[model samples]
Target: MSAVFEAMIRFGLRLAGSQFPVFIFPLLVFIVFRWRAMFSSVRENPAARLLLSYLLVVFVLRFVLYMSGYPYQGRYFHPITILTVFPIAGGLLLIGRYIEKFKRGNLLAWLVLAVVAASAGKVLNPPDPKKWLKDIPDAIRANAPADGRRTELISVVEDRRLPFYAKSGYHLLMPIFGDMFRDAEIFLADGASETGKKLKGKGASPLDLEGRKGGIKLIVRFDEPTKLRAIAFLWSLTPDKMKADVSFQTVEGGDFLKAELVSSNQEGVVFRQELTAKNIIIAIDVKSNSLWHLSTVRGHGFDSYQVFTQGYYNGMMKWLPEEDFKFGLQSVTQAADEWGGDNVFILFDATIPEVEKALEERRLRGKIMPVGEFTTHKGKPLSLYRGIAPDRRD
Candidate 1:
């Protein structure tokens, strides 16, 4: 109970800092400081007393309503002022009558109109944005099997435009692009990812152990014996409190191995280990009470792995051309495969030579197929590919 009250106090303080309703603040401050003098008419006038009661009841009711333990946020509270304004409006009209006896009424009316006009523009033109995966939703609806099959889109925007836009019966699996967009931004804008970072087996996002010191566990399984050379534990910003404990497992035997902390920063933590496991379980022990947002976790031993992401910030805020191709394609694919989704759409510019060469050599035929080609608005060659016969099994 005390904690909730404390939270409310903090909420009120934070909101007061904004000093909103720019036109009303001066009147409110005057009422607060000189309430007795301002409302002195109430003692002698019945109408004035009724107006005071109305204004006071609005706020008193709101106090009771807010204290009833509902979540308090800017969207929910403060609107009660609409009710409080009725009495204020009535009082203002009475004051207008007094001012009319002096000839200031027209000036007051014009001032009110100017204030309304100043605030009207922002209210009419609200700020909202649309997602960029246009035509992909319609494409899925047209081609997807009506037997209620699920298709995964390789898009990273936040709107869930792929899943939400699909008809009720149709199932769509799309990547959850929570601030992982920052990863793409960092890569394209600065190229600060681990210099020799190699893509290994794609795995699930790291699970919160719920303050359990037991560990963060990842199951790494492959057909043949693959030497676990490097394991990159993609983190959610702050991961220093957690320690790495890498282990290996095989049909013959299993052993726990020590993992070297290659590097650590806010983006993620990179750990390197030399171990062998056909099916291995690597666990990371987290310190208590720390929140870790694990966007992705995977092991790297192969030369390169398929990345899945929407090509770049093209439509809407089409500021960069072919800028985010590599980061988006690579990281998003890793998360998609882990989450039981197969990307059906892929696009790229001439920036990624490896993908271009792979396309030339038909190296990605079993996994993905080239679909179409076009030049970007900025005159960059853009090629589209669709994932083919994707393995969506658990």
Candidate 2:
């Protein structure tokens, strides 16, 4: 019996698919039954009434369950079938009486009314399918790379959240050139002594230096002359105080000649020079005072603000140490009494102590509002403090 029922169900589904008109069969059945019930008197037959009532209960139950998040396997078929049954049962009860009264004339009018009612119900209540199916297809199409092509290599100084294609293998390309270009190889240094060791595995030539020092060195090669020009421009602009010596070298018969700078200076006068082995070392004494000065001037304003109080450090303003805050407050505050008002919002991450000391010194006055529970890029939690200074005007 179970096998036979399964076969019947498959046959019904197949028929519904092959014959589009069969989609309305449930609605048609509902209308026939409803018309019969409508024409029958309320007290005419108890058995008929009971059967109609049972069918009505089933229809209501189906509708309620479908709307209340009950999972139905066959799309909207369950709801539509249940709704059609209700209307058909009503029509069954009324159609017989109508047929006796107006015969064929009533058929056309009833059909138009039924269609309007069904369409209105459909519009007011719509079935919403799960979103994954639609969203997945669109996402796949949107993320497909241009022309379905991939770059061989990409480099970045820091790991930024980039597209999937760019993160496969990061090459650390330096911005010394006019434009950034990725070198096939990268050199890693521990201080400066081990720089040569890192390059030993790679086939590229190692850079020769006069003295080994605390700083690190990296060498990259470029194939094109334009690339070299960009590198030279970058080297010239590098801050001289950093004490980085960048020079270019030409390949001799079977070895490399000494490196030379692209530009040179004499007695404060700047002169452009072609990079050659002989005159390269002569430009080593040129000072990069202007570059260092610019960098220092740009960073001058960083120390202007200060924080105070250990409670503030523990709370939201944790980034500034309490001691540093004390120094900053002392530098900016005119009087000790200025620390009593609530007019400044000191923003800092956790782990600062200098700020707390300043609050103790009476350089800054204000209610300390501690804000903790913030995450930094390295996933460290910090706090912030906010309060207005006493003298500020609204």
- Stretches of candidate 2 off by over 4 Å are 1-143, 147-394
Clashing pairs in 1: 200-300, 307-329, 307-330, 308-329, 308-332, 308-333
CA displacement after TM-score superposition, residue 325 of candidate 1 (Å)? 25
Q: TM-scores of the models, in the given order?
A: 0.38, 0.18
lDDT of 1 at 278: 9
Q: What is the lDDT of candidate 1?
A: 0.37
Model 1 bad stretches (over 4 Å): 1-10, 13-20, 23-27, 37-73, 78-103, 131-161, 166-366, 369-394
RMSD from true fold, candidate 2: 29.0
Per-residue alpha-carbon lDDT of candidate 2 for residues 214-256, written as tens digits (9 for 90 to 100): 3333433333444444344435433453323444433322221
Which candidate leads in lDDT? 1
Q: lDDT (0-100) at residue 150 of candidate 2?
A: 28
The models' CA-based lDDT, in order, is: 0.37, 0.34
